[model samples]
Target: MAADVKTHLYEWSTTEGSNLPVGSTVVSTNLDDNLRMIQAVVRYLASSGTVASDTTTDIGAVDATFLAVSGTTTITGLGTVSAGVYKFLIFDSALTLTYNATSLRLPGNANITTATGDVALFLSLGSGNWNCLHYLRKSGSPVTAGSFSGLTAAIATNTIANGDYNQNWTWTKTTATKPALFIGETTASSATDAVILELTTAAASTASAAASQSAHFAGICNRRIRRRQGVFGRRLLVVRYAD
Candidate 1:
């Protein structure tokens, strides 16, 4: 004799703040129903960063270099960057520095061997808070190099060190206004190193918002688990959603 098989159905309303009683049912499951709900939600948030006319309202080509850091260097050649939050990509290569008893500073002792390959990005928190993100892929080196956002605050002060390539930077600016790209390099003779820089722009506000929402939803989804068991034994399903 074979064991009897039991089938069950579950139903939940999509209404806000509603909880229904849980019970088994004999009706056929509607697999497509849940997928439709998810699709709808994703579509709603998908257009946050899309712009209609990027050319008319985007940052164009810009090039900037920082040989000596006396004050904050503002990238030039870029027209007024839009008022909204913006992210920047930057690349730096060829750094030479001299160290004294207390500080490190860039010296005219070294020069970047290759001035066209380093890269970095930054998110400008309006009013002088530029967060730097960087990336460097050395010539003939197998390692792919990059730095995450929030690495360091904008270089406000310059320090000098003896026999060290202490402070050298090359960067570009881009945003919703001038979306062009550019590169630059800095080097010191005493130091045998070179740096390259490249830049691009990203949407600071939209990206951050999406990341936060994803983290919140992930936390909720991780706590729930679904299991099914039958003649084929037991199986567990874990579901996670992100945008």
Candidate 2:
């Protein structure tokens, strides 16, 4: 049997001891869902360093990374251990997978190899033990990044590991401002605060929605309800958040 969701109507009222002079039409949903995921979801991140060119080091955690290596044909070693679930992919060519498991372990107790643009998911049970959950790669086929058009903002088609990613980040649309959730620059996960983007822009404030428009989205976007005494009123706004 599946779990049932309970819904309720939300109303804006006085927060803490302060009361707003005006009323608000805002609603919030309390989620009580269950996820059967063995490994916790983590933020996307870049590798600490090139695999083949230099010995790699992956900290244990639930995170993501792209394998980028140039100037070297063979891999040295993935030193240290960052134990956790990881989504490791290949963005460079000729990079082999090497890790020092003195403090960790891999399934089959062996090192893995991947070509350029190959993506693999793994879970580390701490102490250097890791298991490959899923992987995507083809023989002699290096999957390089290219133009993709699924999002409103087109992250221009470009290859990774050429050290030219700063130039390839071209947004297609200018009107829409999407919040950056995570930016995988250096080899740091969100937990380490190595690649987390900052929210510099102030969030826009807007009025709440009425009961009639409450259930419908695009009604009152992430409008913060504040009790202000003035002639000016707030309006509904559409909010967009990216991660």
Candidate 3:
């Protein structure tokens, strides 16, 4: 059988039997070639020169385990997808890595717009399929969710300010007016006060959370405050955040 070009692994024919005679030069050659292939694999890292990748990457022609890839074309497949085959890719430029359920799987089941210095490791599952094992970005962040840090106290559209739990925001509303809830998502690595607030409506009122830098508000909260009437009495209503 023909040897695999990528790993130089020789496959014996079905009819071929082991414990054959030593007079066969083909058997000796195969043994030597297999030894060399083992040595190459033991070396761990074989780097291919920077090359542009395409829809169907042809790393099979390159005798390397690590590839530095260029170009912006989306890559859908790698090599021929032999089971147990592994490839480490280092992107030299921005490109899109297409995600497929079977053919070319990715970390988040979403296409990745790779940046330079991004590295990804993939393993083949045979039947023309590849699965991404790990993906690392030079920016120290994944491509799954959008996040921001060092949020200031400035209240603008779609931006949150750093504050504490006791801080209160008030909104004036008529009997026909309704209030919308705002949600904030924070990462564990982020500071306690770091938050990304999302407003449900444009007319939704904003509030600060706290005074200290480490203060933060989490989960749903409800507050009751009185709104001044024309001159004499006041009306009280509940300001609550929806789940």
Candidate 3's residue-wise lDDT over 164-191, tens digit each?
5454545565544344444444434356
Candidate order (lDDT): 3, 2, 1
**Clash number for model 1?**
50
Supply the TM-score for candidate 3. 0.51
lDDT of 2 by residue, 134-209 (tens): 5567554333344444557447886444332334354464454453233444553455312132222224635334
Clashes of 2: 10
Model 3 per-residue lDDT at 79: 59
Whichever of 1 and 2 has more lDDT, that candidate is: 2
TM-score of each: 0.18, 0.27, 0.51
Residue 57, model 2: lDDT of: 41
Q: What ranges in model 2 sit over 4 Å off?
A: 1-53, 59-83, 98-113, 140-243
Cα distance off (Å), candidate 1, residue 126: 0.5
Give the runs in model 3 whose Cα sits over 4 Å from its true position.
1-7, 10-38, 41-49, 146-243
How should the candidates be ordered by TM-score, best one leading? 3, 2, 1
Which of the predicted structures, 1 or 3, would earn the higher lDDT when compared with the native? 3
